[model samples]
Target chain A: MAAEAVLAEAGYAGFTIEQVARRAGAGKPTIYRWWSGKPALLIEIYARQPLDLSGTDTGSLEGDLVAALGRLLAFWRDTPAGEAFTALLVEAQHDHAALEMLRAFLAERSFPLAELFDRAARRGELATDFDLAAGLDLVSGYVWARLLTRRLEDDSRSLSSAARLIARGCLRR
Target chain B: MAAEAVLAEAGYAGFTIEQVARRAGAGKPTIYRWWSGKPALLIEIYARQPLDLSGTDTGSLEGDLVAALGRLLAFWRDTPAGEAFTALLVEAQHDHAALEMLRAFLAERSFPLAELFDRAARRGELATDFDLAAGLDLVSGYVWARLLTRRLEDDSRSLSSAARLIARGCLRR
Candidate 1:
């Protein structure tokens, strides 16, 4: 946790193995004994933390979305973990190798939700012909949009609003 | 035209003024004189071939978005400009100065469509407060998700689906 905290504060440009070792109150050998280098350390921090993707599943997609968005906003606003994730995400946008890892991570992490959309669609929670990829893109894309603009703090409510709007369409006629 | 085409073909990191000059049979100084550098040059070309965001107002937000997204997809699919834009955007994520420019450019170029949402909202078309910021995030985030993943071939149907789902509030009601 200490090592993770330090990396979040100091980006890759400023990150070093020694600083992590010093902050964690562990020897350099201890740090090195685990992570081979910077990227490895970043990846470990990313995995070590728990990210909440849970939603209420209120039988209505809209309700589930609203609850999930609250969770996302709560996590994004109050936690160092969220900031660290965003910081690392932002950092990866600059580095190609990091970007690849970031891409892989996003895809892998998001697969379950993709399956969820499929399940919802199969059970008539969504349109028969709805594009799951695009649906996911819209939800996640909106989140990233708020992030890039530094307007996430002021725009939290919109998350649930967006969720409600889309969920209506997916409901049975 | 040839020089512009070359920039579209080669991208920012892959492009050079001399190569364009040679390809276009134009003086290097002419390009350098009009555009200060490669970035400026790319911006000029990207702007010249702007995606048409206009379409018949289909009354519903979903309908209007479909029209707009259709145009954007047509542009992205039929042209090379999207590749150049993607390259510039990904590179800009890591660059401080370029990031500012990207935000400013999006503000100026992308926000004109608030009228689309405003039209719906004015007619009491939305269920709750629409988060333009969040909606924008989802829309752009999808593009970025693909770009970051190196999936540039993905169509604008994703955006169309996103705009529709977001307007309906699939996750937040």
Candidate 2:
């Protein structure tokens, strides 16, 4: 909670353990004892944000992807999670340890897409040789590009177009 | 040249006009007069990197995309331009002017894709209703994601899969 306030108020540039400790009325060593560094604290704070996708399944890959992407973008746009993520990415660029942490975090968070893809496969909708990783990369890449560029608006048209492409490409003929 | 050297040696974090000036054996005011700031200098340096797609058009949308993506990834991995770009994106998050500069630079650099798309249209390979910006966004997003995650290695399989998805999605069915 204190870390969230610190990031929201001061941004990543000023998110120091000392500042977080001061805000939480705790000692610096106590905070350090719990979290190894800024990236670790940032990740924990980000993981607390909800990534609800319970209603994204629409019985079609395109439909599911459109709903999924829309919800994901909204989550990033409307929460401190977005700032926390961008901060983590920037830190990863500068720090090797942070980079590893980010990759691991990302690898562990693929459950949502895995569920969607599994559903698609069960329905015989996916191509026999559909590359799941490739689809994930394309979709996530589009989201990251929009987020990094601060263009995370409700552009349903583009979202639909992207979903259609992936569906058609990955769908069984 | 001095800017490129500075970026290579010191990276974005250590990159400063004063440092560049020192490296170039020139005055800071002279450097400032030539380029407004680090972002401008970075953009200019990045633009100098060759984005040569000379032989990418293989008479098929998928072929062209595969070649183009491969070349682009190689370009990023083999040059200081990649560092300049990641630096620009990181800087954009913290500074408004850098964001605008990055947008402008990206807009100006769309010519390569435009040429490819136009050729596809002429060849009757593209769907009449294909959304150019959406396709571009998907492809470029994939590239940006790979670059930022430090996975710009040659993965022809993923590249081919992505191209197939776009081609099938955008093809005139």
Residues B1-173, candidate 2: write the lDDT tens digits.
89999999988888899999999999999999999999999998898998899888799988999999999999999998899999999999888899999898888887898788888999998877788888888888999989889998999998998888877878887
Looking at candidate 1, what TM-score does chain B attain?
0.77
Question: Which digits, one per residue and each the tens of the lDDT, describe model 1 over residues A50-142?
Answer: 656654566666666666656655665555445455555644644677667767767776764675565566667776657676666666655
Worst 10-residue lDDT window, candidate 2 chain A: A164-173
True contacts kept of 2: 0.68
For residues A1-173, write the lDDT of model 2, one tens digit per residue.
99999999998888889999999999999999999899998999889999899888798999999999998999888888888998998998888999999899888887898789888999899888788888888888999999899988999988998888778888877
Q: What is the lDDT, from 0 to 100, of the residue B123 in candidate 2?
A: 96
Tell me the spans in candidate 2 whose CA falls farther than 4 Å from its real position. Answer: none
Isolated chain A TM-score, each model? 0.76, 0.96
Provide the TM-score for each candidate, comma-separated: 0.64, 0.97
Structural similarity of chain A in candidate 1, as TM-score: 0.76
Give candidate 1 misplaced runs (Cα > 4 Å): A1-3, A16-40, A53-55, A87-99, A111-124, A154-156, B1-49, B54-67, B70-103, B115-137, B154-173
